[model samples]
Target: MLLTDDIIESSCRHNMDFDLKKTLEALLLSTAEPILLKDVVKVFARYHQELSEAQEAIKGEEDEDDIAIEIPSLVTQAQIREALEQLTEEAQAQNRAYRVVEGPNGYQMVTAPQFAEFVRLLRGAPRPMKLSPAALETLSIVAYRQPVTRAEMEAIRGVSVDSALHKLIELELVIVTGRAELPGRPIQYGTTDKFLEFTGIKELDELPASDVLSNHQIDEWMRRSEEEPEEISDEDVGLSKEPKPDELALDEKFVEVDWQRENVESDAAPEPESNENTPL
Candidate 1:
């Protein structure tokens, strides 16, 4: 009898695992976009919790005693990954048009590359839309310094970016995330999922090194400075000037001063005792 019970318990556990796999497969197949593993796990957990609650409710109705119902084992990340892998293999073995693909964003069901031509044919010819140089520059700035504002973009580009920003928004490459907490509360912009899809990249980190642009800008500035040296008048001798290379290097290592903290402290500081008699 003990051995028979053990077999029954094992069969139940196997069925539970199979049901979890089916639920996960349904979720992945139904979603239009890639679903994160954490989200999938949350869904599974909530479902199990509800099931347990229902089971307990039925037990209460059947018996006057408030007995607890046994909850099945919670699905683990390992199980989800394993199920995804199995599904991918099954699709490949059957030569299915769509297959599960893992990318930096998440796991998505994408059409096989070999079936691209057929998909395009069914969708009809695509429209030709190319990004302009200004648009590209603005996009790069938004992609790198994400949550940047239009004013910031203009500052970096050294030109009016109203047109470029409009174009980017129309193309669905960039989106206004929120407003900066500055004086004007300017709208902040950031790249979108479509941007990733267009670039064929999964994550922002996949973009080229950011320091490359900084270095190029520094070189260009040096070149322009050499081409046109600023005139120093005799009266400007005592005035502050750009720091020397050694001083600049030292400044680089120094911690950034918090202007806001400094302002707050200055405001909070007690005013010096007024010398009314001596004051004019």
Candidate 2:
């Protein structure tokens, strides 16, 4: 005998030993990385299979109709999708600090952007080794426009990026991937595994869409720059000066002088003869 839809639904409802939504939530929360749909489905199927076997053992041999009624049916992919959707909506409705987000690989639980300041405070200020603005811009260009060349980067930024490229290479965020097939065969720059690790992304495709500056936006920025007062000094903006080689050498000389003075002062030296007789 074939089992009816109603019977299958009723059996599933009665035999479900675990809440699907809660189980999914727990699984997502337990891992920092995104979880794949297939993995989740496997777990769901296992639960149904175990429940069906337990029911069969308890009920003993039965007719096809009876077995069908006693054993719970496996969950459909549709049901799993529905559960994920409901869980996502519920998290939003409850104003949760974290929510399920669709990443490049799959779905992941991530903290809300609104609480970033609080999270930063909890984690303390960024380390001194954090990338500089120029380096970050260079990295972004490399990420979006991989297999790029130094000349191409300079053309885009309208400035030489020798130092920025050096810093990125030192940090292991960028690497030289083969050379371009151009005249000079310039070395092409691409991101590295360390870049993905630093960015907390599983792959390059997961990077956020690029926000290219429009011509109007560029004009507006130029206008704003023209409107701002000129004659601003680096010192006024609290920017530290980079020490020059000559300045460093002078500093070393000053340190030696101080050390010599300290040594002379500490030594037991005889005093000069007094001029009291001439004054009298």
Candidate 3:
């Protein structure tokens, strides 16, 4: 039967063996995206409320055949969590193609990784998205260091992020949140809901710890970036230093010696003739 409202209401009022886990399983399978825990609880709340209203309406002149079938109490969040856990276990036990996974946002039913190729084939998958390495790096910085400005991203990446940032914004993975309260009030960038969706994470906190940069280290970078920099020479960053007066003189002496030695070697026949005359 179709999952219509009246049908759901009827089920809520009439079902004797209502299984919470099974109800969630139905919900998970029905949704195209992850469902929030609070949303699931609210669905049940509304169901129970509607059932109570219907019960009250029928109580006035019910026929003898209408039995008082027990309606389940309002399901708690803990109950919902427990039910979801059971659903997860059940899916695993059955070696189902889909599994119930929970993330920061809520729970979702996703196809098991082992079935990815099958699903991909079923969907006639499109060409894989091509993100430039630079874009990925910029996206990572934004994901980990968000509420960050383009300047900060460039600082971390050691290059301009304009192109990469623009691409990410176009892809709906990143967005301009607000201006940073810095000297110029630079615009800050942040990851979007689509970013979490793309990454298969429910929220930002679910983002895995970065191996290249931890939060603390990023914080330090930001802190240092904020401070006024001291005067630095090219040598500070491994550039060649200008030769000092003494070093220049030393170099000139070596050049003079090398040049004289070259000239003397080239004129060896004349020197040998002078020495041969002395020997004679």
Cα TM-score of candidate 1: 0.51
- Stretches of candidate 3 exceeding 4 Å from the true structure: 1-15, 62-66, 103-105, 210-212, 219-280
Reference-based lDDT, each prediction: 0.77, 0.75, 0.81
Q: Which pairs clash (backbone N, Cα, C closer than 3 Å) in model 1?
A: none
Best by lDDT: 3
lDDT of 2 by residue, 1-280 (tens): 1334444555667666657788789889999887778878887677667656555554545554454545545767788788888888988888899887654466778777677668778889664368889999989888887888998677668899999999999999999999999998999999997788578776887788755633345446556756858787677899987565577764463333587877888786778898888865
- Model 1, 11-122: lDDT tens digits are 4564566576566678878986888888888876875676555554455355525433345678998899898888879888999888887665777887877887778788
Q: RMSD in angstroms, all models? A: 20.9, 20.0, 10.2
lDDT tens digits by residue: candidate 3, 139-243: 999898888898878888889999999999999999989998999899999998778868877778787778666768977877888899989988999999977
Which rank order by TM-score, best down to worst?
3, 1, 2
Q: Estimate each model's TM-score.
A: 0.51, 0.51, 0.68
Better of 2 and 3 by lDDT: 3
